[model samples]
Target: MRTVHPTVRLAVVELRETSGPAGDSVGASTSTRGVKSTQPSRPTQRPTATQSPMDQFMPKSMSVPKQGQIDSALAKMIAIDFQTFSIVEDRGFRNYSNSLNSMYTIPSRKTLSKSLIPQLYESTQASVRERVQKATAVCLTTDCWTSRVTTSYMSVTCHFIEDFSMSSCLLDCFEFSDIHTSENLAEELLRVAREWQVDGKVVCCVSDNAANITKAMNIFKWTHYPCLAHKINLIVRDALKGMKPTVDKVKAAVEYFHRSTVGAEKLKFTQRQMGKPELRHKQDCTTRWISTFYMWKWFLESKDAIISTLAIVNAPVDALTQEEWGVEERGVQSPGTF
Candidate 1:
C-alpha cells in the first residue's frame, strides 16, 4: 500500500542484507534499497507549435531576417545571372552561406531561372532603353556565325556616347533563317536598328571583310569599317605560308611530345639539367594568329632543351631536324611580330 514517485518507478533498485535487531543477531534480513532523492525531477522542455526547430539551435540575440530582405538578396543574385545549377550546386557558394548562418535557405535553380531572372531582366532592359534613347549617335557592329548545330545567328552590338563617355551594349542576337545573301543581311540589320529605335541615330556599321557583309553595308548605305584585327590576321597568315614546312616540323615535334608521356618527361628532365624552367610546347590555333606566334615563341625559348630531350628519348625521324630547328628559330624572331 506504498506510493512511489513516477521517476522512481523508472530507476533500478538493489537488494542487500541487514542484521537482525536485538534478539537474533545471527539471522539476517534482506531489503530493497535505492539512493535517496532530495528534489522532484522536471520534464525536459520542447519547442512549441509557434517555435521552429532551427530557433532552438540559434543564439537568442540573432533573429531571422524579414522576408523582404531575403527577396532583395535573391534579386541581386539573379541580376548576376550565373549558371542556374551553379547557384544551387557549387560547393564554394554553399560554403559561403554556411559561414553566414545555418538558418538561411538558398533558392533552387528552377526558382532562380524561371521567376527571378525574367523579373530582373525586364527591370534592367527598361533602364538601358531610357539611357540609350538620350544618346546623340550610336554606332553598330554586326556579325554572323553558325553554331555547331548549323543554326545561323546574327549579333548586333551598339556603341554610343552617353553623358560624354563612350558606352557599348549588345542590342540583340537573333536567329537568321533567311538566305545569307547581302540583301537579306541588310534587311535584318535595319530591322534590329528600328526595333531599338536607333535607326536614324546609327551613323556607322563595322564588320569583318566578308564579301557578303561588305556588300550588305553598301546596300544599306551606312558607312562601314572593316575590322582591323581581321586585316592583321590576314597579313600574318599570308606571310607565314612560305614557312609551312618548318612550321609543320615543329608542330609534329610538339604533338609527339604531348602524346608520349615518356617524351614529355624527358623534356622536363633536360630542362632541369640545363637550369631552365620546364616549358610545354603550344599548338597553333587555326583561327588565332597570336596562338601561332606563341607556339613558335615557346619552341624558340625551349629549342636547346627540346633537342637534348629528343636525343634522350630517341625520337623518330619525323622529329625536327637540325636545319628545321634553325629555320623555326629565325622565322619566329623576325620583325613581323604578331
Candidate 2:
C-alpha cells in the first residue's frame, strides 16, 4: 500500500518511462525525495466549481414552501437596515406656497450646486463608482435654439460609460448653455468631466454638423462623429421631396379615413374583415414612419374596404404580407425601402 499524493504519483510515473539520461536522473532524484524533499514542486490545481453539473441548472421551477412555514421561518430571522430621505424648507420673504423652489421663477443654483450632485454621487455603490470612473471618457453633443426667454440656448449632450452587459455608452441628457461658443462648451464639458474625475479621459465628441460643436471638438483635440442618423434623416427627407406628391396623396387619404366618421366606419369594417378588434387605431401608432407602414397593413387587413374604395388598390403582395396576411404570391416584390 503506497501512500502517495496523486500529483506526486502522476509526476513520478510520467518521468519513469521517458527513457532519456535526463529522465533517469530526474526519476532517481524524485523517487529518493519521497515525502521530505528540499525541492520545489508544481502548484496544485483545484477542480473548477463552475464545471459542475449543478451549476448548469437554475432551480427556477422549485415549488415554494407553505406560506405559513415561510412566514414562520422569516420570523425566526432578524434583520436591520434603514434609510431616510430629508426635505429642506425655506424661511424666506418669497411665496411659501409649496416648496423652496416654487416661489421663485429662477431658483437658487447655489442650493443644488452645494447639495445635490455630491449627495447623488455618495448614494451610489462601489460598482457605480467604477462605472463612473471608466466612463470619464465622454462624447459631447450640442444643438442651439432660441428659448422662451428669447435667449439663444445651446443644449449639450454628453455620452458617459454605463455599468452595462453589452452596451458601452449611455447618452446623458442635456446641460443648458447661454453662450454657444466652442470655448464655452469646451469649458463646461471639462468642468463636468472634472466633477466626475474624467476630464483627461474624453476620447470622443459627438454632435450634429454644427460649427460650434466642430470648433469645440477641434479645440479639445477630441475625435468627432457627426450624428450620422440625423444626416441620414436629412438625406431621406431630401429624397422624399421627389415623391412628395404621392406621399401627400396617400397621407391625405389615410388621415381623412382615420380622422372622420366615414373613415372610422371603413376602418371598423376592415378590422372586422381581419377579425382583429384590438387594432382599432394600431395600438403602437407612435411614430409617423411606422404609421405610414401600418396604414398598408391595416388596408391589407381590410382588403375588402380597399376594393370597395379603390378597385386598383391590389398593390402586389410583398414578402411581409406572405407571413402576415397569409397571402403567398408568385414573383413577389418586397417593400424593402421602408
Candidate 3:
C-alpha cells in the first residue's frame, strides 16, 4: 500500500509500541496482529545525497568531472574583442599597421605554412554571383599602370546603381592584368559586367575620351560618356600656351610668395583688408569670391590696405610681352601673371 524509508520505518515502530490499542498510532502491523504480514521487496536504487544544491537535478549515477582547458568562459572574452585573435595562431586574422614616412619600417611577415581552410566554396560562389545580380546596372572604368614590384596592373572600376527609387550609385575598384590589350580589356570588361549582374542593364560605360575605350564600347550596345571635366582641363592647358610667359611668371610669383614668410604676412594683411566691403570705398575693382577664389577666399576686410601697402612686392609685370607697352589693362596694373 504505502512505501516508507528505513529510518522512517524505525521511527514508526517506536511510535506504534508506545501507542494504546485504540488507534493512538497509525500502523497496520500492530493493529492487524491476527493476520500474518510479509515484508515488501526493496527497490535497487543508487544512494542519493540527503543535502546538496544539485541533489534534485543530477542522477545518482552521473559522475562530476574536472573542467577542461577550453571551457565556455574563456571563449567569451575573445569573442567580445576580436583583436585578441593572434595572426600567428589564426592566419585569417592578420595584423596590418598604417605606416607613414619618407623611409618606413618594414612590417613583420608571417609565413603561412599551414592553415585550416574553411568550406566556403559554395558560399564564395554564391557571394560572387550575388554581387553582380544585386547591382542591377554597372558602369566600367579602367586605368592601366605598372607597379613598383614590376607587376603590370590594369584596374577596373565598376559603378553600381541603387537609390530610394531603387537607384543606387556605387563605384568600386578591382585590379586585373595590364598585359591584356584593349581587346583584352574589352573581354574582361564584359566578364566583370556579367559578374556585376549587368547583363542587360548597363546603360553606359564612362571613361577618359580615349580612342581604345571608345573602340571597345563601339562593340557594346550601351552608350559611353567621356569625362567632360577631364577634356575641359585638357582644353584649358592648351589655351594657356598663348599666354605661357604670363602664366609661368604668375605661377613662379605665387610659389615665391607662398614660400616667403614676409610675403605670407603681406597676403594675410591684404586678405584682412579685403574681407569687408566698406574698407574698399568702391565696388568696381574691390576683391570678392571670384576675384580671389583660391588664395584670398574668406579674406578679412582689412586686407585691402595690406595689398596697397605691399604695392612694391616682387610681381614681374613685363613678363607677358617684350614690347614697350604700358603695364596696365585700361587703367589697372596687371599683377605678374606669367
Candidate 4:
C-alpha cells in the first residue's frame, strides 16, 4: 500500500470539509492552492448614522495665536501713550476697529495685560541689555519722588557712548515702598546694577544733593556728582530769601489778577490798547527757582498794561513802586547769569 504525505492529507481534509463531502473537482482545488496574496487583508468598517462623510479630511480645531506683529504694535502704543489696559474694552474703539477690518480681532485687555505687554517689555529689555553689555563704561542718573496719589517711586537712567555716538535708555522705574534710607537706596542700586550685569562698569552716578542720596552714593562706593541745576537752584533760593517781601507783593498782584475775571479781562483789554499781545502772568513755583525768574520777567514785560489795568479796576493790592520794578528787573537778570 502507498502511504499518503501529512501535508497532502491535511489539504484534502480541509477541501472535503469546505465542500461538505461532495467536494469540487481536483482542477478547482489545484487553482485555489499554492498561491499567497501580496496585500494584507484589513477588516472593513461602516460609517455610523451620526458620522459625516467629510470628517476624515478636516482638522479638529484652530491653533491659538502667539505674539503677532499687530499685538506687539498695540502693546507699544498703550505703553508709549500711558493708556490704561481697559481702553481696549471701549465700545467706540472696538467699533472703529471692526469697521476697518471685520476679519481681524482685537485681543482682550486681560491678554494684553497678562501676555503681550509683558512679552514686549521682555524683548525690549533684552535688546537694551545687549547694547549695554557692549558698552565699556556707563553713567547713571537716579531720582525719587512721590506721585500725585502720594505713592513713592524711583527711576534710573543709563547713558553711554558707542561708536562715538551717545546712547541712553531707562533702566528702571519702580514703586519704592521702603523708607529711603542710605542702606535701602544702596541695596536697590546694587540690585539693579547686578541685574543688568553693569555693576562693575558703572563709572559715576548723578543725583540731586539730598542727604539720603549723597549718603547712598558713599555707601554704594561709586563716584558721585551733584546736578549743577539743582546746585544753582539752591543758591538762587538762598539769595532770594532777603527779597521775600518784594517777591510776595508781586505774587499777590498775580493772584489778584488771576482770581478776578473782571481784572483779567481788563488786563487783556489794556494789552490790546497798548499794541501788545495778550500774555498772561505766570505764577512762580516754590520748587522750581527758574519759575521765579519767569514770574519777574512777565511782571516787567506787562508792567505798563498791568499799571493801566490796576488803575481802572481799583485794584486792592499795593502797586509796585519804581524801586520795586528796578529790583524785579535785577532779579530777572540774576537767574540768567547762572
TM-score of each: 0.69, 0.41, 0.38, 0.68
- Tens digits of per-residue lDDT, candidate 4, 160-187, equal 9988999998999999999999899988
Comparison by TM-score, 2 against 3, better one: 2
User: Between candidates 1 and 2, which one is better according to TM-score?
Assistant: 1
Write down the worst ten-residue block by lDDT for model 1: 5-14
Q: What is the C-alpha lDDT of each candidate?
A: 0.77, 0.48, 0.45, 0.83
Question: Candidate 3 residues 1-338, lDDT tens each?
Answer: 12543223121211113333674432434227675456432333334334434543443331222122221222333433543324335433322211222122222222111111122234444655566477656666665555678676555565665453433323334566455556776776787666556658777877766677677777765688887765764564564467555434434444545566776566656656667333321111111212322322212233344335346575433332333122223112323331
Models sorted by lDDT, best on top: 4, 1, 2, 3
* Candidate 1: residue 140 Cα off by (Å): 0.8
**TM-score, cand. 2:** 0.41
Position 149, candidate 2: lDDT? 81
Clashing residue pairs, backbone N/CA/C < 3 A, model 1:
none
Score candidate 2 by lDDT: 0.48
Off by over 4 Å in 4: 1-67, 95-102, 255-276, 304-318, 330-338
| RMSD to the hidden true structure, all candidates | 12.5, 21.8, 15.9, 16.7
Tens digit of lDDT per residue, candidate 2, span 100-134? 33322322335433543334435443544466576
The positional error of residue 215 in candidate 2, measured at the CA in angstroms, is 4.5
Per-residue CA lDDT of candidate 1, range 146-262, in tens?
888999999999999977788988888999988889999999999988988999998999998899989998986899999998888788888888888777877778888879999
